[model samples]
Target: MIPEFWGNGIAANPDNYLDEDEFDSSYEGLLRLSERIGDAKPKGVPEHVIHTLPTKPYLMSKARSPDERCTICLSEYEHNDWLRDLPCAHDFHKECIDSWFKNSDKCPICRRSILENKEL
Candidate 1:
């Protein structure tokens, strides 16, 4: 018979060692185990979730013109309306662009990092 389950709260399976439900639920347990055994620390908030500075307006000068609309809010830019440029050189309306940057660091169209990495 199986021993009474206690401590970490995960019950050992008698048959299959790799139960899908247990594996899915074991993330917190595994994290705790890693900390105890490997001296690993808990992960910090991902950079993608963190907000950063907006791209400067001058960068828009290098952006490529598109016959396409802004994918963020699905609105098109007027011929000479203010547009914000991403490091990827994609352009969007200043208002729409500001809204996106506040929520995420990725370009709405390409998912490129706007602040974590300069390579974009």
Candidate 2:
């Protein structure tokens, strides 16, 4: 009787690689790997993409108080005023943020880069 390993062909040709069917299955396994690699590639931000980023750190007093002033322009924030917050936790008035983003992709106060220069 043939040994179990020989019957499976593993012992018969130990040095041989996987057959086409097995190779195909393994190749399909790389779909997610390719997707992850693609996702990791850096993407370009559109020139027209506008971000309402804050110009200063959002202090608890500024967030809670209606009379708090924006340090950028030294103007008082009024009730119901529209503001935008950045990932760095800074806050700014909407209009100020809009104008700032249009000119550059850096945080108005800290100058942190919002978008990076892509190598062509």
Candidate 3:
């Protein structure tokens, strides 16, 4: 008796399907690929959250030193230069911090994550 085809052309009782060993190897490969993808670094925070940070003008009197500078840009803070303040109390130039937040949500000086200890 001739076996019937399963519509798409494979014989009803054909042996093209993977054996136990082959099936195990393919499953293992998928597991390894998923692990690699999961190992990748995560992206930065949302733009709206970054914008929620506060800013203020630099004042030499309240500064750490006369030559106090923004760690992100290495430039000395001038009076009236806007500074963005993180929840960690580490502040940086508005522009510089904004740029940094595009890639990371942590403070450059303390590496403190602004997303921590607060609900947004």
For residues 1-120, could you state the per-residue lDDT of candidate 2 as single tens digits? 678766766777756767767554366677765765675544433445443333443335534665466656768776567777766566777677666666566676787766644322
Report the lDDT tens digits of candidate 1 across residue range 1-120. Answer: 434564333555455366676664478888876766884432322434332334333333346566556677776554566666766878777777677666566777888766655432
Q: Please, what is the TM-score per model?
A: 0.43, 0.42, 0.59
Q: Residue-wise lDDT of candidate 3 within 21-92, one digit each (tens)?
A: 765457778798768678366656677887888889987676368447989899999879999888888888
Q: Which candidate is the best by TM-score?
A: 3
* Model 2 worst lDDT run, 10 consecutive residues: 50-59
- Backbone clashes for every candidate come to 0, 0, 0
Q: Write down the TM-score for model 1.
A: 0.43
CA lDDT, every model vs. true structure: 0.59, 0.61, 0.79
Local distance difference test, candidate 1:
0.59
The CA lDDT at 22 in model 2 is: 57
Best by the lDDT measure: 3
Of models 2 and 3, which has the larger lDDT? 3
The Cα error of candidate 1 at residue 60, in Å, is 14
Q: Clashing residue pairs, candidate 3?
A: none
